[model samples]
Target: MTQQSLVSRRLSSRATRTFALVSVLFVTPFIATSSANAQVYTRAFGYASTEPGAFPTDGVLNDPATEDGALPARLRRTTVALTTTEAPGTIIIDTGNTALYYVLGGGRAIRYGVGVGREGFTWSGVQTISHKAEWPDWHPPAQMIKRQPYLPRFMAGGPGNPLGARAMYLGASEYRIHGTNDPSTIGKFVSSGCIRLTNEDVTDLFNRVNVGTKVVVLPKNGPHIAARELGPAAAEISVRPGLTPARPAVVTQRAGRQAMNIPVSSAQY
Candidate 1:
C-alpha cells in the first residue's frame, strides 16, 4: 500500500459529499460512524494485546470498485461442526472450500466463497494488513509487465481494473486480499496465487478490518464441498485416505491422490 493517502485515516470527501445535506434526523450520527470506511484496513482476529503480522509486503494495485459480493456471506453464518469458538471480526480464508469467514462474536462464522491459486501457486501463511486503499490505481509488477509488455503502467480505480474495488496490502509482501473484475472465476482454483474475493465481499471486509488484521490460511479451508460432499472424492482416492482436517467443507492435497488426478481409481476397495 502506498503512503497513507490524505483521504485515509478519515472519511473521504466523496463519502461526506454523498451523505451531506441529508434531511434525515439520524443523518449526523450515521456520518460519524461512516468514518470507519475512511480508516485503513486492519485485521483484528481477537488476539492478545498484539503480535507481529505476517506476509507483509509493499506496492499498490489498481483501485477496485466497492460494488458488492466481497464479504464472506456463508462464513457469516457457518456452524461449528465441532468445538472451538471463532473470535469477533475474525477472518478465515478456507481455500479448500473456496470460502472466507468473518467471525461475528459468538461461536458462529460468516463463510464466503473465494478463488485461490491454481494447484501450483497454492501456499499458506499468516500476515496482517499494513496498508489499505480505495479506487487504487494498479501498476503490474515488473514480472507481470515483462510477461505482458502490452500492460499499462497504472490503471485508475474503476470496474475494469483487475484490482476490483478494495485492497488489503499484506504486511510487506506483494500479496493482498483484493476484489476482481472477473466475478465468475471466484471460488475456483485460479489466479496467480492471491486470494480472490468478490467485489462486494471485499468492500464489506475492507470496512470491517483494519491496518493490522491477522490472516491465517488453512490447508483447505475454502473448498466448495462440505464434509458430506467429500464422500465421493474421499472414496475415490486409492492411495492413503484424504487429508482429514477437523473442519468441514475443505478439500486439500490428499496424501494418496495425485494433483493431476481427482481421486477416481477403482482398483482398491
Candidate 2:
C-alpha cells in the first residue's frame, strides 16, 4: 500500500478507537447509577412521608443547630445538674441543651455533649430502649434510594461504621442511639434522622444500660412537647456562654457556706 494510504488508514483506526472509548465512558456511569439505586443505606430520614424506614438508612443524639455551622469537639469531662428525675438505668436526652444524661441516680448523671437533628428533624418523645448492641452492622433501607442511590448498601460495624461503638434501638421504628466516627459532630445537629453520640460516649453507655431502659427525647419547638414534664434540666446547674461548645462555662452560686460556684453545683454531686 502507498505510504499516504497507510497513514490515512491509521488515522481512521485511531478515530474509531477514540469514539468507542468515549461511548463507554459516557454510558458506564449511568448503568452503574441504575444498579446503585437498587441498593440501601440508612433508615434515618424514613419514607417520603408515605414510606416507612425498613433498612438501608439512618445519628446524633440532640442539638437545634446544624453540625456544619456549629463548632465540634468542645464538650469533655463535663457534668450538669438535672432538674428532672429518671430511673438509675434510664437515658434522658434534652434537645434544648444538646446533652444526654445516663442517669447515674440519686442526683448525678453521666453527662455527655450531643448533637441533635437540625431544622425539620427537631422532635420530642418518650420511648424505651427495646434493645442494644456493640459495633452494630448497618443495612440501608429502600426509601434512601429516593434521595441518594449511590450510597453503600451494607456496612459492617467498626471504625468506619457510622453506628459508632454502640446502638440502642428505639420502638418498632428504625431509630437508634448510636456512635459516630465524627466526634466533633457530638455537640451539633446533623443526620437525616436517629440520635448520634460520640464513639467514646456510646461505648461507655453500651456498657451501662440494659434492654428496656427508658429513653426520653425533647422537642425543638412547641405543641409536640416531649412526653414527660421532667422539669428544667439546667435549673440547678448552668453553662455559659451557654450550651454552645464555643462558649465558656459561667457557673453562678447563691446561699450560705454551702453555696455552689462557677463550674460547681450540688445537684450532681
Candidate 3:
C-alpha cells in the first residue's frame, strides 16, 4: 500500500473517533436532562399509571381557578398574635372556629381556615404527623365507604381529588391534614374527619411542616385555648371569664389502645 494512502486511512480513523466523542458529549446531557425531568414529574404529580381514571386527561387539573377559588375574607390565611405553650412547628386545629394555626413561636402564628368534620364526626386529640406525600392517592376507608356508598372506592390524586395538592398523615389513624378541591369548604363543617384547607394554603403549610410535627385538634365544644388571640398583656385569659385556663388532655399510647383524659371521637376521611 502507498504511504499516502496509509496516512489518509489514519486521518479517516481519527475523524471517526472525534465525531463519536462529539456525539457523546452533546447527547449525554440531553439524556441526563430528560431523566431529571421525569424524576421531577413523578415527584410533583406521582407515578403515571395505565389504569383507567388513574389520571384524568380532561384538562381539569390545569384550571387553577376552579380548583382554588377565592376564600372568604374572614377565612383567608393571615398572621395572628397567638399565645401557646406549644413549640414553633406545632399545628393546632380549632374545630369550633374552623381554623388551623401553625404556631410560629414568640406568641405568634400563621392561621389558615380549615374544614372540619361534621357534627357527629367531630374529634379531638394530639397526634404527630407520620407521613407526607405530594398528590397522594386516596383509598376510602371501610367506615367512610359505608357512610357514603356513592363515593368512589379509590381516587388518584389531582386537582379533582378531595385530597388535593398535598397530604400529611396524622399518626396511625386514617385522618390527614390535606388540601381540598372545594375551597368553599375551608370554613365549614363538612369533612368526614380529616382536616382540610385550600390547596394554596395546604401547600404553604405542607412546605413549612415536616414528618413528626405535633398536632393538636381542639374539640368542637371544648375550651378554645389555642384559638383565641389574647394580646401579649392578657395572655392568661381563660375560655370564659373568671375561669382557669383549661389544658388539652395529653394522649397516651398503649399496646393496641390509645387513651386520653378528654372524651375523644375518631373518624376517617
List model 3 lDDT by residue over 91-135, tens digit each: 999889898988878887878888888768778889999898877
Residue ranges of candidate 2 with Cα displaced over 4 Å: 1-74, 222-269
- Give the lDDT of residue 138 in candidate 1: 61
Winner on TM-score (2 vs 3): 3
Residue-level lDDT for 240 in candidate 3? 23
Name the candidate, 1 or 2, with the larger TM-score value: 2
Model 3 segments more than 4 A misplaced: 1-69, 225-269
User: Which numbered prediction scores highest in TM-score against the true structure?
Assistant: 3
Model 1 lDDT tens row, 20-81:
65645567677665544222111111101111221111112122222222333442223332
Q: Locate the minimum summed-lDDT window of 10 residues in model 2.
A: 259-268
What is residue 12's positional error in candidate 3, in angstroms? 81
lDDT per residue (tens digit) for residues 171-217 in model 2: 65556788764555566667645678665556556767778788888
Better of 1 and 2 by lDDT: 2
Q: Which rank order by lDDT, best down to worst?
A: 3, 2, 1
Question: How many pairs of residues in model 1 come into backbone collision?
Answer: 49
Question: Residue 14 error for model 3, in Å?
Answer: 85
